[model samples]
Target chain A: MAALGFGLAYAGFLGLCLAMDRHHAELLRGRPAAGRRWLLRGVGWLLLGLSLLPCLALWGVGIGIVAWLGLLTVAAYSLVHLIPYAPRLALWLGPLLPLAGLALSLAPT
Target chain B: MKQGFRQCMAWLHTWSGLLVGWILFAVFLTGTASYFRGEISDWMRPELHAPAAGGEPAILAIETLKRLAPDSPTWFVFPPGERNSELRVVWRNPPGKPTPPGSRGFGNMVLDPATGEPVTARESYGGEFFYRFHFQLHMPPLWGRWVVGFCAMMMLVAIISGVITHRRIFADFFTFRPGKGAGRSWLDAHNALAVLALPYHLMITYTGLITLMLMYMPWGVQAVYKGDRGGFQAEVFGVAPPVRRANQPAPLAPVGPLLEEAMRRWGGPPGRIEVQQPGDASAIIRLTRRDSEQISSNPQTLTFDGVRGTLLGASGEPGAAAATRGVAYGLHLGRFASPLVRALFVLSGLAGTAMVATGLVLWAAKQRHRHARAGRAGFGLRLVEALNLGTIAGLPTAMLGYFWANRLLPLHLADRADWEVYCFFLLWGLAALQALFWPGLRSWATQFAAAALLGLLLPVLNLLTTHRHLGVSLPAGDWAMAGTDLLVAAFGLLLGLLSWRLFRRAGRAPVTRPVRGAGLARAEGA
Candidate 1:
């Protein structure tokens, strides 16, 4: 569950980064269209909000919120470091991470 | 007007951060290490290598304290728990009595829970040194805390003014151009580090002040309690007045039942057991709920009549104001966090340390560039550069030296614990001398290389000196020992890479470029 929360946060931040003109140019090799930018922005905000569900389930309300904030920091920092050095890899990892997290969640203990 | 206001804020942020940046670096680095203080202490004491014993730690601790300090007025027993494996105890001396040798009106011992006997480990302060140095900086308690408190206030100012000055905070949120020139690159690194962990930095700084609030701002207590600080503490913290000794020596009731009852009541294990006047008719036993059980550092204690073994009373839930303070204190200490959350806390702490490190280096890099353009380095720039190198590189080298001294120092050496601390200062002083004589890129490389060597060699030293090496510990599933060795070596590798980079750079002529975004960088005070 914690892993899922972290993955969703990373994916969310990646979406937001793709919506930015500079990062979009660097990662996707072209400027984002107006509609595409808005779509990415909406999906980014929605994913970030969705990340909270796993956190709230993992820890209770009080600590869960704190955990969510911390995860966001980690996720954003991770994206920042990765995007500067490995833009394509950073983009690929966003979708891959959530899928990996989903696989782990379904696996038996 | 807005530009002028931001310029003013940038100036404030620069000086506020630079003036005490060295001290803040040390505090942050040491404080980050303190999150694992218990594990560090456990790793230091290799003699107590046996796994957790089957015996109840509370029973063993009580028996040991009974025999050791029979006549002491009060005793505090901390039974083995998740963080620590040793049953530790401390006892206060009777009033007006001469303290025993090597003790200052109090005595403490670490007992192995398996045997209820004192663990004859080599004398060392262990992780408690780093924990104490985090806030106190090894000075007299009052002076050290006040100095740290003042720096924390400056850090708070720097954070706020920095945010105000950085106009492109969101636009540059995911931006970090390490390939850029020295000034630009350092600025980017500093900004990224600071912005990424901004919430942690804010929380930690505010709560750090709150931790020592009483000393820093006692006006509230004075106004409310007529300067009777003790009374205020008693009322706010629910500390019952001390029970007088009845002079009639009586047997202390068995603590086993009381321990069980307290556990049943709290639904969790108690962290500390305090017995007041343990051998007298007026004796009282107080059990404090463990810190890990809640997000409040405040103690929720249940008191019992010591002689009769009957429940006397339990402390009520704290008032809202007190509870808020407790949560703040707990958040700063992070004792309630689980392992995963604790790791996140450590990551944030490292980011904070890196932010300060990058900021200090950025100041020097900018000044050096300016001096190059002016044809010579001025006295102020030179001084700041030397201080920056000495503290940022030298402190870590000194800390690693302290750990080495722990393993190498002879067991029977007099005042062995104090000697370990002296070694730390001695190495740091040497590094400072080196920086003073030659404050250049070469000096930076030398100190970093030294730090790298010390850190990398620690695990090998452990293997040679003690049986509790990675070979033995990893196989035995002793994560504390294995983790320490692995983490130190990892840090060593990082320092090595840094040293190599500095060495390579030092071999070439210094370059001075008109910093790109010089205006924004200066305005942001990076």
Candidate 2:
């Protein structure tokens, strides 16, 4: 559950960062087009907001916030490093990683 | 004095950070490890590696107390938990019957819950040494606290100044070009780490200061309580002050009912019980709930008359200021967190340590660049280089050496714990000497390589000295033991990788001149 929360939070943060003009230009081909930026921003907020659910469910309000922030930092840090060489991987990671995390979290221990 | 605000802050940040960076690095590293203090202590005392059980801890505690110190005025029992397997009991004489002022008279032992027999683990400070050294630096208690308090002030100033000094904090968080020039790489790392965990760094530093605030800024308490620190504590925490013993003897009531009553009232298990004047008519039994169960780290207590088992009422709820202070302390200590939260706390702490380390390296690297332009990397740069290597890698090597000494030293050795500590400092001193002789690249790589070797060999050494290897521990489902070995080996592997990378990086041409490029401008200016 914690891992899932961390993953979602991380992915959501990266999505927001990737939506930014600077990071988008650096990590992807050219700038994010207008529609794509809006879509990225919308999806980013949704994922970021939704990220709170698993954490709140697992660890409650106070600790959930703490865990979510930590996950965001960890995820952003890894993504920052990944952008230099594996831009494609970093780009896809923001959208797909959370799904994998959710699936893994739902599976039995 | 005539500088702009940001310039002043930059000056403050650079100098304040450099002056105490070495001490802060040690503080941050040891404080980070202290998050896993219980687990580390468990790893140190390998003989007590029994699986945690579901037995009644209070009953086991009572049994031990009866056998050990039945007539003692006070007793403290730390029950076995999910991560802790040993049942520790300590008994002490009542307050006001002082051998000396501010002195505690107590005897403690760790016992196995199954057999109620004392578990004679090897005499070593274990994780406690790291925890103590973080704040105390192995000095006398008062002096150590003052020193740590002063350093903490410097740290708080550095963080605030650092925040103001950075113009593009958010942008810096997303940028770290590792293979850049030495100065740029170190600055990037320092900025990235500091900005990435900005909230944690700020909160941890502020709360760390708060934890020692009463000593540092005592005027409020002094004015309010007329210099009676105990009175201030009793008032703020809502606990009774120690009472004069009524020497008259009376049959003490059984503590089981009192414990159960307190638990029922508090809606949590009692973590400890203290019986004041246990054999007398004035005996008072205080039941303290575990701090782990509350957001507030303050352990709330319920007092009862010991002879009749009648409630003497509970301590009043803390006021807003006190409660806020308590929560701050809680966040700093993080004793209330679960395993996952605790792990994140450790991670953030490591980031904080790395931030300090990279800052130190950035200073040295920049100075080296300046001195290189002048023909020789001067004494100041060399000294900083040597000190950086001495602290960053040398401390961990000494810690691992302490673990090795625990297993290698004879059990019958006199002052065994002290000897373990001596070995730690002695090895650390040797590493510093090696760093002084080797300087820069060789110093960093060699110490890391040595540390890597020790870390890599830790489990093997454990397996040889004690039969509890990862092979035995993992298969037996002993996660604590298994986890310790795996983590140590993983850290060893990380150290090895770092050493190899530094060696390679050093072999490459030293980038003396700053590269002229668009994004590289700040790198040159810094």
Candidate 3:
């Protein structure tokens, strides 16, 4: 569950970053302001928020929060650096991550 | 004298970090290993590999105590936790009891709870040595803590100043180029690690100081507690220590029932059992809950009258201030973390160690670059190089030596633990001497190769000595043993790779780069 949370969080953060004018132009071959930036931002926030569910499901609230934050930091850092080298992979990852996370979360413990 | 604040911070960060960099590296490495301290201890004591009894440990402990120390004033029994496999028992004399001059005030031994027999595990320091060395450096207790506390303060300063000095920290977070000139590569590595885990670094350092807050800054505690350290402890932990033992003799009640009661009250198994005045009329038993069930490090304990197995009372609940302190200690110790999170903690610690190592190397590389332009290096650069190699590579090599000594040394040798520790220091000293004498890339490769050799072959040695190889351990589900061997092998591979890299780079002349800002010579030359 925590692994799923980390995956979803990383994906969500990547989506939000790509939605920005700079990252969008660099990675998507589009005007930075052209994509549904607000929509991406909104979805990113929702996914990031939703990632906490798996964490809370695994560990109780206090430890879950700590784990979630740690996962968030690790994911955000990795996604930021990963975007430059594999922009296409990074773009695809933003959507595929939550699906993978969902599959992992529903798997029998 | 008229430098900008950022430049001043840069200067402070470099010097302060460099000054204590070696010690900090040692502290970080040992501290990182300590996250698996219990498992390490288990691996070191191969003889204590008996399968679990799957019976009530409380009953086993009571039976063992009855046979071993029937009249001892106090008996402390520690059942195996999720990681440990041995039950530990300690018997202590009452207050004012006469003791040998060098006695530790108690006698303790590991027991196979199944047979209720004392374990004949080899006498070695085990993981406790690394845990202690993290903060104590194995020196006199007070001085060790003082030294560690001072280094921690310097570490905090270095972290803060480092952030201030790295003006392009955010911009450079994505700018790691590994195959560049030595200085740039080292700087990039240091910056990436430091920034990537910046929050963890800051939190660990700050909480490390907090763990020893009373010793480092005792004025507030002293004033509030009126210098009564015992009182302060009692209030914080809420343990109502037993009074003097009554001389009247009385048999101890069955501990199993009391343990069951404690588990019921605490909603979990009791982590530890402390028996006070075991054979006296006023005996008491205290049961503390396991740390895994809570975020705070402080265990909630319940006390019972030992004679009738009746509940005396529970310990005091921690106040807000005490709870905050407990949280800080918990975060630093991370005893409550699951296996995955604990592994993460170890990674962060390794990252911290890497950060310190790179910072030290960066300083040396820059100086060498600056001095090489003048056709020679200075004494300071040479010294830093030797020290860096000695510590960065030497420490791990020494650790490997310690493990080798455990396996190779005579099992019946007296003071075996001391000898094991001596081997560690002796190897470390030899590495330092080798570095000093042979100084350069050749020495680096040699030291790294030696460490690699020792680390990679430790499992084979263990197999030869105890017949407990990974082949046997892995299939048998003895993870603690197999895991240790596998990790050591992985570390060995890393060192081997590093040794190969150094060997390849050895032939090239020092790579000299332009000195920037104040001629700090902070760029890599070779």
Candidate 4:
């Protein structure tokens, strides 16, 4: 349980750090996009929420299946939505992936 | 031809990849199966099945090691992991030494838990065979690995060029429309799995390549130093201690105390033990941890002086290349990690197989128009088409037959178990031949029918042969045997449905292609 929690938290922490890093980089370069920033924040909150969910014992299984579906669906969605620019799509989703998989794995059952 | 460099490379990448993709798929599938090697061994050998080793392994280890290998160079005990329980002990015997019949593994023996006597289970090289086979297959050693490594290299190039070639990767994701044209659906499945798991595909391929990079690129070592493969291995892996002939041929250290110390220190007993120079000048014992179920790799090894039991340095203290290799191996195995990680890996592996299958079908679909236009379409195109058919459809047919063979073959036949697996490859090879001769649609329908019939019949075959069928097994919750039977039946039913559809489709069209060339070149039976 501790391993699962630590893994989820570490993954969530990494995603938040990377998202913030990218977001801050955009701001530093004077390419401030509020929409993208909001997206990053949304991702961060999602990670934070997922990271904490392992702490809740009973809901782990239901949450895990949902998380699996959610990660897969999101991956499929992101891939489909990002047309022509395969590299860009990969770059954005690649780092998020370890998190997606790790978070999904934390769910019980 | 200067204008065709990019095209030539692309062609090379595609053809080389397509040629081995099916085999690679089999390799990956079987390789993944081996992650549960110990459990699979337990499942196969119902007798050796202990209750997941309910007790503290200290006593078991002390007892088993003392009883089993008191005279050997090193006594090793792999005392169960998260996924598998049932302690296994290994001892090295020389090549010429008489090996008892039914010994599944080479060089080592697994002790019977009850008597701690070297015993034979049902013939299973178990997951180890698949692991060793995945890279080179069970072919003649280095040559086999080279062949597999070359194919993996081709795969690496194929992945890169495939990404380059796909113009609508994103647009096609989530677009799999069933009962739509086979080509379109294949494309959607391919794009969705590939593009979505792009990093995984990339990482797995790259890491796979790196895993055997030294073997492939042997020139660098040849140029730098004397070409001693063993020396290179020792230097690079650095995990194995340098050989020393133990003067006076002294007695070896006991394993129980070391294993006790190791389990206490690391909460798990060693996964394996290495003995350097069995009866020589400098013999040593190394105990390897069966790494935690974390996604990260690191199965630590504690080396001790064989005679005096002097504590040598631990292998996985974070800074060494051996540690790096340990993690790499762990990641590849996906066994050391938690069950959740393994489940994810299995899912990913399945997705990868789907990704490859869908890609082949899509490529065939896209080329349909081109083949239609080119009246000059000759053996090459026809060969590729048949190969795609054989691999995509026939491998499963062969696999279903393998399970059936297990049930159908006489239980008492000498070497029956190994031969059953051999029958799998043999039948699959025949399926390739069948794919070549039969019309593509007929081949698809026939093979699917074969898979369905064999898979569904497997349960009945078991009942006839072993008197153990799913209905009785499942009610009793004998999950391993019964579950396997049920799943095979279920898969068979699914294949039966597929066969019905393919048969219906076959009736609708007189699809024609060039005479097949018996394209087993891509039929890699991993």
Best by TM-score: 1
Question: Per-residue CA lDDT of candidate 4, range A11-66, in tens?
Answer: 44333433444324422334336676567557755755664455345235523432
Model 2, residue pairs in steric clash: none
Who wins the DockQ comparison? 1
Model 4: residue B66 alpha-carbon error in angstroms: 6.3
TM-score of predicted chain B versus true chain B for each candidate: 0.94, 0.91, 0.94, 0.80
Residue B516 Cα positional deviation in candidate 2, in Å, after optimal superposition: 29
Pairs in clash, predicted candidate 1: none
| DockQ-sorted candidate list, best first | 1, 2, 3, 4
TM-scores for the candidates: 0.95, 0.91, 0.91, 0.73
List candidate 1 segments past 4 Å from native. Answer: B100-102, B508-526
lDDT of 3 by residue, B1-526 (tens): 4358888999999999999999999999999888878778888889986457566766787778888777777888888777777688888854577766656778788988677678899998888999999999999999999999999999999999999899877556545555677488778778988987887899889999999998889998789988988888887898775568788888888888887787777677787898888877899888888787777787688888888889888877789988888778888887754877776677788888889998988898787676766766667777787789899989999988888998888999999999999999999999998877766676777889999999999999988988678888999888778888988889899999988887777645444341211111222343
* Global lDDT of model 2: 0.78
Cα lDDT tens digits for candidate 4, B206-317: 6677677777887877877667777766565456635545456766676667778787877866666666654444778777776553333554678888777778877544
Q: Which of the predicted structures, 1 or 4, would earn the higher DockQ when compared with the native?
A: 1
Model 2 Cα shift for residue A25 (angstroms): 2.6
Candidate 4 TM-score, true structure as reference: 0.73
Residue runs of model 3 more than 4 Å from their true location after superposition: A12-50, A76-97, B1-3, B95-101, B507-526
What is the C-alpha lDDT profile of model 2 across B1-526, one tens digit per residue? 5359889999999999999999999999889888867777888888885744545666667667766776677777776666666678888854445554443577778888666678888888888899999998999989998988888899999999998899888665577676676477678888888988888898888988898898889998888888999888877888888656788888777777887787788776677777677677888878888776666766588888978989997877888888889778888887754777777787899899999998987887677666555656566666777788789989988878887888899987998989999999999999888777755564577788988998899899989988788889989977667777887787789889988876665555354342211111123333
Worst 10 residues of 1 chain B by lDDT: B514-523
For residues B1-526, what per-residue lDDT tens digits would candidate 1 score against the true structure? Answer: 9899999999999999999999999999999989989888887777775547567877788888888988889999998777777688899987788877768889889888887888898888989999999999999999999999999999999999999999999999999887576488899999999998999999999999999999999999889898998899889889888899899999888888888988798787799999999989999999999987677788899999999999999998889999989988988988754777778888899899999999998987787666556666677777777788789999999999998999988988999999999999999999988777766677778899999999898899999999999999899878778888888888888999999987776655344342221211222222
How far out, in Å, is residue B323 in model 2? 1.4
In model 3, state the lDDT of residue B369. 73
Error of 1 at B375 (Å): 1.8
